[model samples]
Target chain A: QKEVEQDPGPLSVPEGAIVSLNCTYSNSAFQYFMWYRQYSRKGPELLMYTYSSGNKEDGRFTAQVDKSSKYISLFIRDSQPSDSATYLCAMRRSNFGNEKLTFGTGTRLTIIP
Target chain B: EPEVTQTPSHQVTQMGQEVILRCVPISNHLYFYWYRQILGQKVEFLVSFYNNEISEKSEIFDDQFSVERPDGSNFTLKIRSTKLEDSAMYFCASSEVDSLRPGELFFGEGSRLTVL
Candidate 1:
């Protein structure tokens, strides 16, 4: 089974709506979860980060992780046109030396104005 | 507001030829990493470097692939012999602390490699 699974969504939503993105993982060792935003032909930019299970909020973006279910989520409130991009869910173990991130397939989002 | 930077935004190289992608990670960051992404796939880890040595690598990072921190500021990934499957976008990233800390990693714009 793949380590991380995410819906490759070309999800479209109206502006000012609430957008939800989710991911599931098979690895129980993952202790760090993150959300990244990628523009067309650009690199992945860090959006939200959460440690283990719980929630983290940053302005309009919120990230939640549930270790027991191996599920993680990102919620965007008052979504704007500028928020249109591919959202990637990434995670990694708690190793101190080599902490390479494992990423999801990414979901493409579009905010219709 | 420092960020990682990669060279040769896009490169088209002939198969079997050698190619080198360079990156300048954020200053003061001690951990560095290389990741790859195909046209429609997820980002995969290639290798990680720390203290001028390779800390870890993925199975895809075989003998054909090698990483070198040639100097103080430059970290490079060299493909000794390129293959068609090697065509992908390579990203360089760096973080101030390890995963134990809350510090987030910063990524470069990425270098697109096209092997024909």
Candidate 2:
């Protein structure tokens, strides 16, 4: 199984809608989960970050990680046209010297104005 | 407000040619990294550097690939012989801390390489 799996969604939603992006992993050792936003031909920008099995919120974005289920999610409330971009889920193990971040295939999102 | 900066936003070269991509990471950061993403694919890790040495590298970082921190501010990736498969958007990232937190890593806009 792939270490990380995410739906490559070209999911379209209207403005002001609630958007949820999710990813699942096969590695139980992963302890830090992150969400990144990437625009066309641009680099991935960190959106939300979480450590262990818990939730972290920043502005309109929220990140949730469930260690038991090996699942992580990014929730966007009051989505705007500016939020149209690809959402990527990334995670890394807690090993002290291991800095590699395993990433999932990003989901493409388009918010209609 | 410092951000990572990359050079040669886009480059096209023939297969078997050598290519060098350059980056200047955030001044205060100590850990540096190189990552690549093929069209429509996930971003893949290449290597990570700290204290002028490679701390870790992925399997994809083979003999043909090399990284150098030639100066205080510049980190570069060199491909000895590029293949068509080597075409991808290469990103440079830096972090203030090492394994302490991956979330603090800052990424550059990326240097796109097209091997024909």
Candidate 3:
């Protein structure tokens, strides 16, 4: 099995809808979790980050990690059309310098107007 | 906000030819990384560099691949002999501090390499 797994979603939702994206990992050592948003032809941009098992909130995004379940989630509130992009979940074992990241197959999301 | 920059936004190369993709990481960031995504596939880690040495690399980063911080500001990924399979979007990223505690990474726009 892949170390990290995410549904390759082409999920479409109306503007102002709430969106939830998720990723599951087989590795227990992964301690740092991050969500990245990538527009077409662009690189992944960091959106939300969380450490271990907890929830973190930023502007309109929330990241939740459940270590026991080896699952992580990114929730978008009041989603906008601008939020249409590929969402990637990445994890690493440590925060130490230059640690290689393991990434899931990205989920493509579209917010319809 | 400071951002990572990559050069030659697109590259077309013949098979077996050598290719070098360049990146300028955020000036103050000490950690650097290279990742690639084959069309429709997951983004895969290539290598990570810190303090002038490779700190880690993925299985995909084989002997055919090499990285160099040839200058103070530039980090580069060199593919010794390109293969059609090597055609992918290469992304460079850097973080101000180690990724501990959910530190974020700033990524370059990416260089699209098409191997023929």
Candidate 4:
């Protein structure tokens, strides 16, 4: 099994709809969780970050990590067409400079007008 | 705001040829990394560079791959011989510190390499 698993979603929703994206990991060692948004032909851009387990809110975006369940989520409120992109979940076990990140396949989301 | 920058927005190379992808990491940042994404695959880590040497590399980063900080401002990933599988979008990222304290990475626009 892959270290991280995310539903490769082509989920489409209307503007203003709430969107929930999630990922599950089998590695109990992963302590740092992050969400990245990637636009077509562009690199992944950091959107939200969380340490260990807890919920973090940033304006219209909220990131929730449940270490006990080995699950992480990103909730988007008042989603807009501009929010269309690929959402990727990534995690790492250490703060060490050489630590490599494990990433999920990513979910493709689209907010329709 | 300062950000990472990559050269040659796109590259088309023939199989078996050497290709060097260049990146200028954000100044003042100490950690640099290379990642590649196949057309429909997840971003895969290639290698991480710190203190003028490779800190870690993924299994995908084999003997045919190399990284160098030939200058103070540039970090490069060189593929000894390209294969069709090498076609992908290559990204360079850097962080002020490692993955601690919300260590955020700034990624370059990416270099699209098409190996034919």
Candidate 5:
């Protein structure tokens, strides 16, 4: 099994709808969780970040990590068409200085107008 | 805002030919990395460099691959001989701190490699 697993979704939602994206990880040591949004032909842009099993909110985005299940999720509130992009879940073990980040296959999301 | 920039946005090479992909990371960043994504696949980490040396590398980063910070600002990934499987979108990333907390990384747009 892959260290990190995410559904390759072309999830379509209406504007102003709430969207939830998730990823499951098998690496018990992953302590840092992040969500990145990638537009077509562009690099992944950091959207949400959490250090442990908890929630962090920024603007319309929220990131939650459940260490017990090794599951992480990204919730988008009041979604907009501009939010259409691929969302990537990435994680890494803490303080392993210079350890590379492991990324899951991104989920493509489309916000319809 | 400063961003990671890469050169030769697209490259086409023949199998067995050497190719060097170049990147200039954020000036304040100290940690550098190379990651690749084959068509319709997950992004895979290749190697990480810090303090002018490779700190870690995945098994996929075999002897055929090497990295160098030939200058103060330029970080390059060189493939000794390209293979058919090496055709992918190569991304360069960097972090300002060594700590993995929150895992903040800045990535380049990416260089697409097509091996013929």
Candidate 6:
């Protein structure tokens, strides 16, 4: 099984709709979680990240982590057409040099006008 | 803001030829990294560098690959011999500190490598 799993979604929704993107991991050792936004032909840009099992809110985005279940999520409120891009979930253990950070396949989201 | 920058936005090379992809990370950053994304695929970690040494490397970063901090401002990834499967978009990134921010990793626009 892969260390991290995310549904590669071509999820389309109307503007102002609430969007929920999620990721699940099998490793109990993963203590940090992050979400990234990647536009076509561009690099992944960090959206937000949470330290552990908790919720973090930044602007219109919210990141939630449930370490007990090895699950994490990013919620977007009042989604905009500009939000159309690939959402990727990434995480790693506390030790920086022990291993390279792992990433999910990413979910493609498109907000329709 | 100061973001990472990479050279040769697009490169096409013959198989078995040596290729060096270059990057200039954020000037004040303490950590540097290399990542690649094959078309239609997620970005994958290649190697991480800190304090002039490789801190971590992925399995995909094999014997054919090497990294160097040849100058104060530049970090580079060199492939000894190119292979067709080596074609991908190579991105250079850096962080101001040592943490999970490789996610927020200030990435260059990326160099598209085409091996033929």
Q: List lDDT for all candidates, in order.
A: 0.91, 0.91, 0.91, 0.91, 0.92, 0.88
TM per prediction: 0.96, 0.96, 0.96, 0.96, 0.97, 0.95
Clashing pairs in 5: none
Instruction: Write one digit per residue (lDDT tens) for candidate 2, span B1-116.
Output: 89999999999999999999999999989889999999989999999999999999999999999999999999999999999999999999988764455655689999999999
Candidate with better DockQ, 1 vs 4: 4
What are the per-residue Cα lDDT tens digits for candidate 4 across B1-116?
99999988999999999999999999999899999998889999999889998988999999999999999999999999999999999999998774445446778999999999
Question: For residues B42-116, could you state the per-residue lDDT of candidate 3 as single tens digits?
Answer: 999899888898988989999999999999999999999999999999999998774444447788999999999
lDDT of 4 by residue, A21-86 (tens): 999999998999999999987888999989858899999999999999999999999999999999
Q: Residue A71: error of model 6 in Å?
A: 0.8
Tens digits of lDDT, candidate 2, A23-110:
9999988888889899987788888878968888899998988899999999999999999999999988864553878899999999
Question: Can you write out model 1's per-residue Cα lDDT over B1-116, one digit (the tens) per residue?
Answer: 78899999999999999999999999888899999999899999999889988988999999999999988999999999999999999999988764445436788999999999
Off by over 4 Å in 3: B98-103
DockQ of 2: 0.59
lDDT of 1 at B88: 97
Q: How high is the lDDT of residue A82 in model 2?
A: 98
Off by over 4 Å in 6: A95-99, B98-103
Residue-pair clash count for candidate 3: 2
Quote the lDDT for B78 in model 2.
99
CAPRI quality level assigned to candidate 6 from its DockQ score: medium
Error of 3 at B8 (Å): 1.0
lDDT of 1: 0.91
Output the TM-score of candidate 2. Answer: 0.96
Candidate 4 DockQ score?
Answer: 0.68
> Which sections of candidate 5 miss by over 4 Å?
B98-102
Task: Record all residue pairs in model 1 with backbone atoms less than 3 Å apart, i.e. clashing.
Answer: none
- Fraction of native contacts (fnat) of each candidate: 0.52, 0.43, 0.71, 0.59, 0.69, 0.45
DockQ of each: 0.62, 0.59, 0.72, 0.68, 0.73, 0.52
